[model samples]
Target chain A: MENRFEKQEEEKQDWGAYVKPPQTSRPSQESEASAQSSGEQLQRFEPRSETSSALCDIVREHLHALVENDGAIRPEQAAAMFAHLTICRDCAREFDELNRIVSVLNSMPLSPLPHDYSGLIMLRIEREMGGLYPLMDIPPNLATSSWTGEAAQQTSQSATQLNNRSLAGILSQTALPLWSRVVMLGAFFATLLLFLTSAWGRATLDATLSTVQDWLHQIAQATAEIPLLGAITAEAFNALSQSVHLLEETYLHIGANAMRGVFLDTAIAMGVYFIYQGRQKAKRAG
Target chain B: MRTVTLVEQSDAELVRHTLCGDKSAYNTLVLRYQRQVYNLAYRMLGNAEDSGDLVQDTFIRAYGALASFRQDASFLTWLYKIASNLCIDQLRSRKTRSALSLDSEREEGREPANENRCNAPEDMAVRGAVQEVVHHAIQNLPERYRQVVVMRHLQDMSVEEIATALDLPTGTVKTHLFRAREMLRGRLRPALEMEADGK
Candidate 1:
């Protein structure tokens, strides 16, 4: 990870590149020499001249102190800086630029508040306050009620028991292999079929089937007696049938789309795997 | 039915009322400082949504710890301290989690369309560009310098107030502010010059 200072240093280097050309064009040999120097000594031991690059550095350091102190530097230092700026064109220009930048920053407008700023904050505070003291708003009468006390306790106990029972049921269901469950269901159905094939069981099944058919026939006859009702019922049944057909079509379309996606994914995965393997092989050969 | 105007209450008066079980007094306090706190957070975090959440969290934390608040300290400075700490924590966590991408920073820097209410489109565009450049420069400052810069320039805080909030010496805050501004001046010079040339 890059340290924040390292990033700032990189930015400084970039800025130096941008600002160097103007300084280099100056006719001062000492400016170029100071600019070329490296390490910590560059800042401390660089030779100063009226048009030298180090002049800008000196002016900048003083400018920062002056600006931060709101021009309240000692009179002697301020006079010296002003005198230098009057004599040095480069330092004066740099000073004006730095001052302009500071003014611009200080004068940068504050963003306008959102229209409902206070309302939103109050809402949030209220919500947080409610969370902090949940029962603060509850009336004293309701706070001491039996329903909120003993009844709540009973409800909680019942909920716990229900949760435990449901957990046990889930565990039991998962304890058996899926195939075993299927086999058990199939065997039960087979035993029921065998019992129905016997005389008494067959008789009971036939009677129930006949009763369902007779009820359907009666409903159809009553509907037929009212032609309007019969037509509406027929239309409703047709709509229901169409809905079922549409649902089946949708299911098929989704399944086909899912299969296509899976195939595409597998192909991409295989291509990546081959590429990776080829790279590994080439590495070994090299 | 005795009534008093909430806006008339001083911070100390409001704190007194809040401690005495009047929630409205606290609400009044939130209303008073919400914008400053939000603007500070927004400038620090550079995301409006995150800043909003920080503001809400700061107030909630302040409410919870109101009992320990010292009477001698300025309320705004105390609130700023909480917000600054939260923002620093966020920045540290973010640095640890992943490097911030320039693309995401650009995206976050885009203001909401509705928020731009300036009448002159050209001037607004120029101002926006300059603001973006300046914001990027500030974001690039090291963490300590960045905090002082945001507090002083963006938040319009006094040096003493900032020193108090950050628990730093007055001279140290001044030094950081100076360095931060110098770095910003270097970074913003080219872009601002271009804008000037274009004009």
Candidate 2:
């Protein structure tokens, strides 16, 4: 009994009547007209089958549904009663032909959607989600029906139009070429050696330093000029004090530790000068 | 002009707004193309979670690289390229890992049952069996062929659209679709023969 039931189940699995509507290849008006005419032709003429009356009745119903639906016969309907349809050659032929027509009809596509699909799409647009394009103001005149490549291209082109240069460019300039940096170091040492070894160069250096100090002392009038001159003067004084501190520790016979406070004093002055310059620049720019 | 405007703005305008930091405009694109991106990822990866993440990642990466986007390529096409490359990378990584991954395991488990059940009854068990078979068969297809076939049939994309999106020639898209279909037809022949024999 179990084997028999299994066999019956297997028999029911037959796809003799199961037909998927041919995915409509085209939905041309002419093709639709022809499908209607072909359907009418089938309606006017009933296929004759030398088979059981019940089987014939099934075929007629299936055929009528196929015509009315323009070939949208279901696979479930076809598979349900394959036994009768397979034996009747005429019905099978008619079914196969109709199935082909339905495939084309199925390809016709769904109905025209409402105009608001675009609006619905607009509502769903995210501010942060454009894959390659950030959002901005688009002119009201350019809105349209479908998203075309031309439009995407235009938007992508526009998104990159702003100038927001980053600080990385300035930082990258700090990386000097090896040869030039080495040359600069060599020139600085050469000038220092010349100043110390040559009595005339040393006198000239002392004279120039005194003149610079006098000029620095005179520049107390304008607060605006303080940052510009003060930054340079502070940097010069810090370097001079650092060298003097080293000299005092090496040869001055003074308590070297006493100059610790001098280094700190120079550093603080440089820091204050830089901070003041930064604030002034910020205010001016603002 | 009136009809087009009544419907929506041009894609170019939308892209322009997107570039100008109009956050909503970019969202429009995301919502418009997320399904396509998701579908491609799903077909390629055969895992919903991975596909979803891949789509999101693709969008994120695309956003970062938006400044370099060329105007000549279709936006969706550019996006597909990003999504496809990501899927391919995921697939390649899966291949190198030596362990049999979840996607593979699902394929291995489902393919045989699907083969057995396509001609089976319409009951729940049979329906599940057929669905598994469909998924398994599609999942097992070569990555390129699998993408083309899904993009064509499931997504209802035209060969031209698929070609444009993938940056392949139309001929290539058609060929891939044809070969993919042939492969499916062969895989499915057993069920057809079974149905034929039962009759």
Candidate 3:
């Protein structure tokens, strides 16, 4: 036995070379009292099988109920069972021991990790997948753009407008939920159509457009003095300006009929969003 | 728009992102549950090397099968299912190879591993002896009993969760748990006595 223990102690020492040290705790001290009292409040859960009963074990019949941890036993039965344990010293000793084991197991501190496995696991995953997956989709940035690439100079005003919309679309999708986007965009176009139907609506559109244009210019100019940001902000402002110009021209070309289509599309989107809302609510309720 | 940090995303959201080919989202998931998985494997397999290997395999297997994961069900329990199956396979394979440890192959009527070592409470009251004894005692339990006890008691998995993970009925899981504790009672009785001695 001493040799066996010596071997185990050696093994534990070797294990400590990689694994963190085990915590110092006495299992007996953990949950001694609450086991019996909690047992009294629990509902009785008699096991269907007594197959585990050894020959000569008299309290084998009550063993399952006597040490029941789950609330399968009723309080009255538990109390009576506890009382019965007192009558049988052997059963009482078993109950006390079982309770100690439960408490100790319950309070057993989780074994600590030896080290962060993230870097190694991630390294293996990256090799397995053949590339590093970026933390999130890389946001559009002029800073990271290839200045030497032909695409930078070749990007036309229309291409920039498309790129601007693409960026906006990505950000909108990421930052806002579908319902919020639907509500905001649908309401904006619907309200715009409402305004366009009257004489003030065109002015309102112009005002909103100009306000947006001015805000872009202000941001562009304010950041222009900051050296590195000046180019990106100027490019962004130009894209927005072109987008606003395209919007006004499109409105003029399509006339009031296009506004009607906008209203119709907004109505459909709103309907779809509401139906989505209802389904989500039902799912959560279920 | 600010990018949502990996920490801010829910498990479901992470799963969705992973399915969408976001590798980092899966990493977030691995980092979140690796400790739990490693500990589960350690308790089940009884070694650090195998448990560490199992943790990596669990995550990799989970990622490979993420497409089939039912969004409505639990992510952690699903991982448990994978981990438990792997553990059983490893144990069975070990048994097949005749490499199963003597402690693991313990018969019900056999002498306790430390019976002679712990003849008296005073002899058993070494520092960390209770945990060490309990650990060995758990290692002695039959595989099925060990799985249920580790998942239900150690991992804090609900009965329903254990049933789902092990593909057993809740009633059967409860039976296994009770029998496990019953087995533990005899082996661990010494530790409790040592504790009662306040060592």
Candidate 4:
């Protein structure tokens, strides 16, 4: 029995070498050598007793746990299983094969996700949900344009418009409290009034109100002063002058119209106030 | 910025918000699990389109049944169970279709040509082949064994977790896993030996 125990210890050492190959400079080559060695270990193993059948049953029962735990069997229990594997070639071969299969399984690379896989899944779910909820649309800038290439420019513009519309939709939703909405509107109109009526605003407005020719002359003078800006900057300056001229024309047109429509504007504001008051009264009554 | 904070919320917190009729919260749950569910489906069904369909169906089913979901149960595990059951159904239907199709034999003959175009390195190709063989072998196992194998190996669930997910005894789960591994080892040996020899 002592001799048998000594032999078991020797076989266990061999099993360790069989499981863990020597480290080498090349990882791929080391793995190949290990695989070959493991295969050879399986081939050379020999069964020493007729009790192999019972041992095989034990191996089968504990196999999953052993493999799952990465063969870190406790010393006491390892003696029996390792002894059985050392003497019984069939169980040993099966054990080696199980280890190889598991290593391969664990080493298996994950398959690449399908193109737009998440998007496709989400789209399907949205479709199944009766299209009641809008699916999260891809941002125009991020959406792949490879299919249409340059033709996507037009589609991207529409996508941008859709994004803007969605943003507006969210802002209009009843998520904001009434008090917050009122505060936001008040702040917005107050800022607009200050921009329209302030001294700095009026001075800036008058400065931008130059005639088309005068704007072009000013742009040319600015372009001459910044010679390092080159032809591109000059073209940019010319575009800016044209834009300012258009803005000035638009400002004058609006000013003329506003002067004639003061009474109408007051009437409209009173109408809106009355409508809001009536709705509040109706809501309170209900 | 708000989205970043939303994404950082725990699954339980998201689920709570979802229960409170927050649609975007449910969307967060979907985003969190979509990749994992899709990958699981792909590994089981071995096809992107079918996997995608399974993922969508899984989410929709989960959403519809969210009210019944016990808060204490793992949301990921629950989602995986749904995906696994759907994958099984998909595999069953695919098997029926393949058995009925006369061109399946021809398709099998063309498989080598398709495999050659996998566009991977030698080690990667071997790994891919190993995975394919394992997946095919798994698909051939009995339904219970297949489910246990997927949960144990692919989904990386522990024995107890698999048992809980499948509503099986832990012993049963282990037995099925052992049996599945045995079957897989048998199917994979020749290919593995060839791979070893080639290397």
Q: List the candidates ranked by TM-score, beginning with the highest.
A: 3, 4, 1, 2
Q: Name every residue pair that clashes in candidate 1.
A: none
Q: What DockQ class does candidate 4 belong to?
A: incorrect
lDDT of 2 by residue, A22-71 (tens): 22321112344554554454444434644445566665555635433323
Candidate 3 collision pairs: A42-A73, A43-A72, A43-A73, A43-A74, A44-A72, A44-A73, A44-A74, A45-A72, A195-A201
Structure candidate 4, residue pairs in collision: none
lDDT of 3 by residue, A1-286 (tens): 3221221232232321221112221111235464444343332432223421231153455556445545554443344344344333344456556666777787766899876777777777767853322212322233333334433333222223333454343442243455576577548644643554333564756657666567656766776677765777577656655566566666677877766787677778778977986787466334
Model 2 spans > 4 angstroms off: A1-286, B1-7, B99-125, B128-132, B190-199
Best by lDDT: 3
Decoy 3 TM-score against native: 0.54
- Give the share of true interchain contacts found in each model: 0.26, 0.17, 0.35, 0.30
Query: Each model's RMSD to truth, in Å?
Result: 24.4, 17.9, 17.2, 17.0
Per-residue lDDT of candidate 1, residues B97-174 (tens digit):
765443234334433343223333334336657776676566666668888988887788999899999999988998
lDDT of 4 by residue, A1-286 (tens): 3432333454343434223322321022225676456446644555555455655776666655666664445443455565555445556556667877777766656565565444554566556754332222211232343435443444344333443565443332344435546655554543433333333455766643344336555656667667554555467547655665454455566674553365356557656865886676466334
Per-residue error for A160 in candidate 3, Å, reads 20
In terms of DockQ, the best-performing candidate is 3
**How do the residues A1-286 of candidate 1 rate in per-residue lDDT, one tens digit apiece?**
6322221232122221122223432222223243233222333433465445554566556776655545345544454454445445555556656666677778766765554355665677677664332112211222222345544444334333332454332332233434545555554533443333333444666644334335434544555557645866445434433344343344356664554465466557556855875676466334
Over B97-158, each residue of candidate 3 has an lDDT whose tens digit, in order, gives 86435445454545545545433433545564677677767777888989988987789898
Off by over 4 Å in 1: A1-59, A115-286, B1-3, B99-128
Isolated chain A TM-score, each model: 0.27, 0.22, 0.28, 0.31
Give residue B33's error in model 2 in angstroms.
1.8
- DockQ, every prediction: 0.12, 0.09, 0.19, 0.15
Docking class of 2: incorrect
Residue B124 lDDT (model 4): 44
TM-score of chain B of 4: 0.78
